[model samples]
Structure formats: structure tokens, C-alpha cells
Target: MASWLARHGIQPTVVERASALRLGGNGVDVRGDAVTVVERMGLLPRVRELATDVRGMQFVDATGRAVARIHTQDPASPEIMRGDLVALLRAATDVDVLLGDSIRALEQDDDGVHVTFEHSPARRFDPVVGADGMHSNVRRIAFGPEERFITFKDHYFAFADTDAALGEDRWVTMFNTPGKMAGIYRSGNHAQAKAYFMFRSAPLDYDHRDVAEHKRLVSEAFAGEAGWRTRQLLDSALTDPGFYFDALGQVRMNSWSDGRVVLLGDAAWCASPASGAGAELALVGAYRLAGELAAANGDHRVVFPRYDAAHRPLVNDKQQIGPNVRLKVPKTDGGRCVRDVVARLPLMKAMSAVERRAQARNARPLPDFTRAA
Candidate 1:
């Protein structure tokens, strides 16, 4: 997104609520239309260079017996770490990024939008776009309350770095119980490993911003687990500063824009984390949004609706189906068995091929902006 804007002579001021760039998150997939966007931005080579070499996934029983395997080299898919992609995007732009600052309020009119920041001074832009993630303050100010948009999918997940000696490099080993799952991901360098845990749960009443409370909840839930590497990972994860926890939820909104105020990325439509499309969607969506605005000569009245129309179909297609929580974290032992069995079937291969074809068919080629001059 920053790349597209800078190429078009639109200078953007980036405000990040964090004190510095975040270096957390699991690997993310970049396929279909998103791959095209990255190539267009001239970051394809860089992205490939930094790609995470995750080999495959291995499902195991409590006794540590391997049950099923899914190679990461599956022809229909490709993946990279979230941090690598963010680094590439950040390096592509010359925008002035303001860290430790957040927008407190937004007021927009037909002419422009005025924004007040939590620490920085007030500023106005010709347009305001909220590219913030699921818990977007921009969405709240422009649209209604969050309850109207967030749909919880009855699960909670946590992940963090661990110190245990996981056997191999570049493979994710998973162990499943009735309603919970624990896994260890070994990265290419082997300098770091990640511990992941998830379980079925109804929506719980808690403060979303409370990290300490989140850690407490995760520790309490997995306190009784034994063997198969669960206790070691859990103990290490709780003490790690990079630990993250959140409810598996999706964001659904009827419209993505209002006047000069618009939304891009997860702020508008998040198909949920399990869909593995958040980073791809954000990167691709930002590219298209900026392209549309540039093509329309920065006249958002002409650009916003078109951008929404062009992108909403993809979002609808991906999210209209139920959340993918069941596929990522199976709820029951029977469910896990069923998932493993189905994964090895020829029908699964066919379904993956068909889905890729559908995505390709729905993709709209980005315009050649080099000739815009």
C-alpha cells in the first residue's frame, strides 16, 4: 500500500500505536491474486528471499504417534512468515511513520477529514483510511459499535516462542485432545521455535487489552495437561514476552466507506485468522485501493464506491462460508480423525484445485500504472 501511494506521488503519514515495528505472528500464505500484487509492487524477489521454509504439518496422538501429514509444498498453496512480508512492505515506502501514536477521534466533511491523535498534534488529510486490524478504532468512529460487526467463532488461541528442544527443523508437530490442540513450529534457522495452543470455547467476558489476564486464562486452561510436550511449551509460552492470545472471530460489515472516510484491509472485512488471508488481503487490498484512488485522480467520491465494489465480492466469497476454525483446530477426537482421513483423499486435492481456479477467475488484473504518466 505504501509502495503504491509513493509511486503515485501521494505522501502518507503512518501512525502506529506500538512503540516500534512488531516482530510477531505465525506464517501467512500468499497465493492467487495476492501474488500478482506483490509482483507488481516489485517486491517479489525480496519476499521470496525472506520466505519461511516451513516443511509440513504432522498430526500426533497423546502418545506422540504420528497420525497424518500435510506437506507445506502442496502444489495449491505457498506460505511465508508474517514478519517477512511486513518488513518488505515497510521497506518499499518512504512514508513518514509515527510510532507510539494513535488516532483519538476522526471528523470528516465533504472537503476533508480532521484527525486528533492520542499524543501527536491534530492533522487533516484529504481522505482518511483505516487500515488498522480487527480491533479498529477507525471503524468504531466511522461505523457503529464493534458488537455489530465482530462474530465470534467459539474458540480461543494462543501462541509464543518456546525454549524446548523440538526434534526437527522446518516442520510443525501437532498433538490433539478432545477439545484442545498443542503444537510446536520449528523455523528454518532453528534459533527460535513457536508453541501454539487452541481450544473450543464460548465467548467469554474479559478485557481484550489485558495481556496479563490473557496469560492467566491460557495457563489455567492447560494446567492439567501432561506429556507429548504440552507442559514444557505451556510453561515457556507463559513467560515469553511475545505471547499472543485472542478469540477466533470474523468482521462483517455491510459497507466499507462513508464519504471521504474509507476502510482497507481487516478493518473492513476480516474473514477470520483461520482463513489465512489477513495479510494477503491487506496487502492486495491496499494496492488496489491506492490504484483506484490514483486512477480517479484522488476524487474519492468516484473512487471509494468502485474500490468497495471491486473488492467486496472476494471478501464475500471467502467469508460467506462458515469460519475455518474447525479445520484449523478440530474440536473433538472424532473430528480430528475425520479431518486427517479427508486430508489424504483425492477429493481434497480436487477441491483445492477448484478453489484456486475460482480465485483466479475472480481476480481482476491490476492496471499498468507505469504508463499513468
Candidate 2:
């Protein structure tokens, strides 16, 4: 968002709640039009350098035998660690990003917006966009409460930094049990590893900000569940301080804009991790949002609608659960076995063909904002 805005005449002040950039996350992929957007931004080469060249995903059993392997070799797509990507993006932009502060309240009128912050003095801006992510403070203050938009996907997921050697280089190793899955991903580009845990559950009642509560929930859920290195992964999760836990959820809303304040990226339409399109959506959304605003000559009212019309289709399509979630976390043992069997069969080839076509169709044509604006 910052990068695109600065390319035009507008300079946006990025206000981050974290004291510093929290550079810890799982690998994120850029596919289709999103790859084009980064190319336009002139960061394509840098992205490729840091890309986690994961050979494939391997489903394993308790005895460490490979049930199946899906070789993820797409010349057009490359998955990069989220932290490294963000750092690169930050370096690319010259915008003033204020850290350790957030909007406390917002008031909008015919002219502009009045914003009060938790730490900084109250100020106003002509167009105040909430790129604040899924649990967006800007959305809460301007649009409505969060519960109105957030739809939980009957599951929970977490990832943490770990030195737990997955023993497999350039492969994501996953073990499935009834209603749960635990995985270890090792990148050939990086020495450090990551641990991922997911499970089927009803809406969990816990504080979003409390890491202890989230950790407790994960620990209790996989307390005795046995499978390939589940015990070791759980132990690693317990010891890691940089753990991330959240419900698998998507943000569905009627409209993304409210008066002069608008939402961008996950704050507006989070398709969740299951979609494998969060980073893609975010990059494309940011590019379009800034582009529309520039095209409209900084008119929030006109730009907001234009941005909505251009971006929502791709967002809607990606929100569907489809094969990505089911293929990874089958709810029952028999279902998991079926998945394993199918993954190893010729049927897997057909599924990949279908996915390729869908991705092509979903890759919407991004307006050349650099030229058009």
C-alpha cells in the first residue's frame, strides 16, 4: 500500500501497533496477477531470491513413511517467508511509518476524518484507510463490530519458529490424525525451521491477544494425540515464544468502505490461510487500492467504489475452502486414508489440471496503474 501510494503523489503514514516489525511468519506465496503486481513494483527479483523453493508437500504416517508427495513446482509461483517479504517491502517504500500506536477513535464528515490515537496526538487525514489486518481497529471504529463480519471455519491453526529439524530438506512433512494435523516445513534457503498445527473444532472461546491461552488450547488439543513426531512438535511449540495462534476465519462483508474511511487487504476480505491467497490478495488489493485512489485524484468516495468493483471477484473466489483445506486436514481417519490414496493416484494429476485452469481464470487483469494513472 505504501509503495504504490508513494509512486503517485500521495504519501501515506503507516501506523503500526507493534513496537517494531514482527518478522516471524510462515511461508507466503505470490501467484497469478499478484506476481505481476510485484514485478510492476520492481521487487520480483528480490522476492525470487528469498523464495522458499519447497520441492513438494509429503503426507506422512506415524512410522515416518511417505503416504504421498505433491511436487509444488510452478515456474510462475514461488513461496517466500512472510518475514523476509515484509522486510523487503518495507525497504522498498519511503513512507513514514509510525510504530507502537493505533487509532483510538474515528470521526468522519463532509470534508475529512478526525482520528484519535492511543499514543499520538489526534489528527486528521483526507482518506484514512485501514490496512490494519483482519482484527482491524479501523474497521471496528468506522464500519462496525468485528463479529458482524468474521466467519469462523470450524478449525484452529498455529505456527511457530522452531529448530526441530524435519529431516526432510525442501519438503513440507505433514502427519494427520483424527480431526488434527501437525506439520514441519524446512526451507532449503534457510537453516531455521517452522512448526504448523491445525485441528477441527467448533468456535473456540479465548482471548485473541493472550498467547498463553492460545498455547494452552493447542497443547491440550494435541496433548496425547499420536502420529509422526507430534509429541516432539508439541514440545517445540511449548518452548517457542514467538508462537502464533488464531481461528481459521474469513472476513465477509457487504461493502469495504464506510464514509471517508476504507479497508484494504485482510481487514476487508481475509480468505484465511486455507485459501493460500492471503499474501496474494493483500499485494493485489494494495496495488489496486492505491491505484484507484490515484486515478480518482484522492477522492475517497469515488476511489473506494472503484476499488471494490475491481477487487471483490478474486476475493470471493479465493474464499471458498475447495481442495486446499480438505487435502491437508481430513476430519476422520478413513477420510485421511482416502486423501492419501487419491493423492498418490492418477487422480492427483487431474486435480492439478483443474487447479491450474481455475488459477488462470482467477488471475484478473490488473489495470496498469503506473501508466493509466
Candidate 3:
């Protein structure tokens, strides 16, 4: 997104709450139209170079026996650690990024948007875009309280990177019990493995940014699981410095803009991580939002609505495909068994192919902004 804007002579100012660009997280898949977006940004080769080379994912039983497998080769999508992608995007653009600072408040007028940062002096931009993620400060100041637009899916998940010796290489090994899941994701990079745990629960009351509280919640939820290599993963995750926890939720807004304030990525309409489209949506949406702004010659009143209209159908379709909690991290032992059995069937392969094709068909290519030159 920054590259697109810079190429068009617009210098963007990026503010991040974190002290620096985050350099760790679970891997993210870049597939279909998203691959096109990266290619257009001229980052595809670099992205691929940093991609995670997990050969497949295996569903395991309580006894740690592999019950089924889904090979990455069957449906090829470039998977890179989220951090690597963020770094790539950051390196590609010359935007002024403010780290360890965030928007405290946003006030807009007919002429521009005024923003006050928590650690920086007040400033104004002709437009203010909230690309800050699901819990967006910019969105709240511009669009009202988050509870009105966020929907919880009654589940919580946590992940952290740990020493790679905890799991095997070239595969993501997952195990399930009734209403809970525990797993280890092994990347080709032997430096680390990711510990993941998820359970069905009503949204817990806690501070969103409190790491200790987040660890406590995850520890409490997965404390007594008795099988499938849960103990070690739990121990490592609880102590890991990079542990992360959040509810499985969706952000749905009636519209994504007000005055000169607009939103992109998870801030505007998160289809949820379960959709496997969050990164794709972020990349594609950012591109289109910037393109629309340029196309409208800086008139956000004309551009923001167009951005929303152009992106909504894709968002709606992916979200309506339903909560994929069960698919990625099945709850019941019986459900896991069923999933394993189905995955081994010929129909599963066919269905996966069909689904990929459908997603590609549904995606409209982002406009070529260079053409508008």
C-alpha cells in the first residue's frame, strides 16, 4: 500500500502503537488475487523467498497419531510469516512511519482530519486512514464505539513461537479434544515453532493489550488438557515473550468512512482470521483504497464510498462462508475424526480445487493505477 501511494507521489505517514515493526507471528497465506496484488507491488519474488515451506498439515488424535493430512502442494499458496510480509511491505515504501505512538483522538472538518497522537504533537492530514487492525483507535474516534460493529464468535485463540525442537519440521501438527485444540506449527526455518491453542468460550473480560492477562486466560483454558503433546506446548507458550491472544470475532460496519476519515484492512471489515483472507483483504483493500483516492483526486467523499462499494462483495462472500473455527480447529473428538476421514476422501481434493477457483472468480482485480497516469 505504501509503495502504491509513493509511486503516485503521495507520501503517507504511518503510526504504529508498537515500538518497532513486529517481527513474529503465525504464518499468513498469500493466495489468489492477493498474490496478484503482491506481484503488482513488485514484491512477489521477495515474498516467496521469505515464505514458510510447510509441506502439509496433519490432524492428530489424542494419542499423537496422524489421522489425516492436507498437503500444501495440492493447493499451492505462498505462505510467509506475517512478520516477514510486514517487513517486505515496509521496505518497499518510503512513508514516514511513527513507531511506539498511536492516535489518541481524531477530529475532522470539511477541509481535513486532525489527529492527536498519544506520544506526539497534534497534526493534520488531508485524509486519515485507520489500518491499525481490528481494535482500531482511529475507527472508534471516527465511527463510534466498537461494540456496535464487532461480533464475537464465542471462541478464543492464542499463539507463540517456541524452540523448534518441540515439533517436527515441514508440517503443522494439530490435536483436538472436545471443545478445544492444541497444536504446533513447524516452519522450514528451524529457528522456531509456533504453539497454538484454541477453545470455545464466551468472550472473556480482560484488557486487550495486557500480555499477562492474556497469558493467564490461555493458561486457565488449556491448563488440564491431557493428551496429544499439549503439556510441553502449553508450558512453552505461557513463558514465551511473544505470546498473543484474541477472540475469534468479525468487524461489520454499515459503512467504512465518515468525512475525511476512512479505514482499511481489519479496521474496516475483518472477515475474521478464520476466513484465511485477512491478509489478502488487507493487501487488496489498501491498494484499492489508495487507488480510489487517487482516482478521485483527493476527494474522500467520492473515494471512500467507492472503496467500500468495491470491496464489500468480496468481504461479504468470505464472511458469509461462515465461521471456520471448526474447519481450522475442530472442537469435538468426533468432529475431528469426521474431518480426518473426509480429508482422506477423493471428494475433499475436488472440493478444495473448486473452492479455490470460486474465490479467484469472485475476486475482481485491483485497478492498474499506473494506467491512470
Count of clashing pairs, candidate 3: 0
Best to worst by TM-score, what's the order? Answer: 2, 3, 1
Tell me the tens digit of each residue's lDDT in model 1 across 1-373.
Answer: 6678888888888889989988788888877677777778787776666666777777877778777776655423457777777777888778989899999988887779999999999999998888887888889888978899889977888898887385357788888777788898876743677899988887888887788998998887787989588988898888888788988788998888988888888888988777767876786788778888888889998889888888877787677444246655787778988988875666655675687678768866656664542
Question: Candidate 1: deviation at residue 352, Å?
Answer: 1.3
Q: What value does the lDDT take at residue 159 in candidate 1?
A: 90
* Reference-based lDDT, residue 208, model 3: 88
Off by over 4 Å in 1: 74-78, 320-323
Off by over 4 Å in 2: none
Local accuracy by lDDT, each model: 0.79, 0.88, 0.82
**Residue 371 of candidate 3: its Cα lDDT?**
63
- Per-residue lDDT tens digits for candidate 3, residues 1-373, read 6677777778889898889789888888887667888888889888878778888778887787788887764234688889889889888888898999989988888888789999999999999988878888888888888898889988888999766786778898888887888888898854778998888997779998898999998888887887878988888888887899998888998888888888888898887767878887888888888888778888887898888888887888778644257766667767877778877777666776787778668866667866652
Q: Write the residue-wise lDDT of candidate 2 on 71-171 in tens digits.
A: 87576888999999999999989998889999999988899899899999998889898988888989998888999999998889998877647548898
Ranking by lDDT: 2, 3, 1
Best candidate, TM-score:
2
